[model samples]
Target: MAMLNPMPYEFLGVRHKPNLNNFFGFIYAKVTVPSSVKVPVLPWKDPETEDTIYPRGFFTGHYFSEELKAVEKLGYKVECYIGYEFSQQSLFNEYVNHFYEAKSKAKERWNFEFLTKEEAANKMFYTYAHEVVELNENHLILVSDTTPSRELLEAQDTDSVFVQNPLPQDIVGSGLGQFKDELK
Candidate 1:
């Protein structure tokens, strides 16, 4: 799909550096495996304008801690991404079919709503980027042949975070603690 507003290619902090082929694997690994949350959207009615507002998406976070406490505790690496539900009936049927075939069956299937990679990236960029205050290096980065596999668990270590998984329990408690407080 064409970029809606120009790919925020430089938004990721690590994108500024040179020779990132090695990092691409790391980033892809992070994407293939994520620990995320099902954030609820509460509809709000404007008091004066009386306009209805629909909640867009849920907040999500990785399982790793600043001290790598969670990763160490869980004995693996973890990361997360956000997902949004949007209307896409205008899209071509063949595109929809192809998307369905490519996507996993973990999320609720809505005939008129679907999630896209661009939406996922925007969600993560807005919700979790500022929350990443630190990084830990104690963990070893490993390579897997099936790194692009759809099975979240198989593609990522138990410590890895994901946007969506067949099992919700894997990422129930990885929300942004301080960041959530800030939002409140």
Candidate 2:
């Protein structure tokens, strides 16, 4: 992952308009997690062209707002990169693998579609999303470890990176609010 010019990187998300039946009929997700949807193809025909089936489209934010808005809806709007960071092809792989692994048990239906060098390179919307997951059991655990081990979380390797949190509830750090306070 080589970042030449060093630009700010933000995770993208997605939003899909569910059919009238909701949950596509029959089933429903018990738990919804923030995610990014990257599908290879759609079974339905493209209404716009009236003949094509969305050839391996990678993103879909054009549906509404960008990825950030989706994340904000998830209540994780504050999550963001604090500085310039580099990127690698694997970054995308690591992302989708999460859902793949979780759904692996359902083998025939949920196994991940291994992406190729070209597919990986052909990254699409590259945005954010809120995934629907069904958790029916009594006990549930969410493992939010993005890194390899707990050590990384304890000693986050922020050597050149700094992740910023959302702004606090009452103080305006800029603009008219600051001007009004200054008047006092």
Candidate 3:
């Protein structure tokens, strides 16, 4: 129930770009600037143009999404910002608070229903993740208070490429890429 809060899953499909979708009706009401989160910037400027290549802002006037700023082998340089508008604050606060609440509740569920985090983690690494994992900077979305976040992507010794996350990586789906063979 809480996972589907703010907006329903199907409803979120509006902004999915036909590949990935999300409910975008929760548009930010205020137009003020955002400044809570800090994003990393490039250390050097464009040699030929004599200008910075990236602007390093997160408020794209749409929903929650980030452009991969840079990659350091296994980690990503990501951008994060908090807007000041009433609508902006409302949405941001809701997302954060709701997520925290969900995590707490889910952890309780895990201990009550299944096993402890240590047991699950140490006992063959059996997946006890309640739902789709959303690795935050230091916590798993609705998993545990002490569940640590990864600092870099651990590629599975294969050539498959995937986006980086400050938290951890949990890709949703691929559209055309999923059906590339069928397209061919």
Q: Quick one: best TM-score, which candidate?
A: 3
Top-down TM-score ranking: 3, 1, 2
lDDT of 3 by residue, 149-180 (tens): 22333332222322243322232322211211
lDDT, candidate 1, equals 0.32
Candidate 2 error regions (>4 Å):
1-71, 79-81, 91-184
- Model 2 root mean square deviation, Cα atoms: 25.7
Model 2, 91-175: lDDT tens digits are: 4445445555554545447654555464344333122223467785542333433443332233322122122433344643322
By summed lDDT, which 10 consecutive residues of candidate 3 come out lowest?
Answer: 175-184
Residues 122-165, model 1: lDDT tens digits:
55765867665544443223233334333333333222333343
Clashing pairs in 3: 12-22, 12-23, 16-20, 16-21, 34-83, 103-142
Deviation from native of the Cα of residue 131 in model 3, angstroms = 29
**Per-residue lDDT for 142 in model 1?**
28
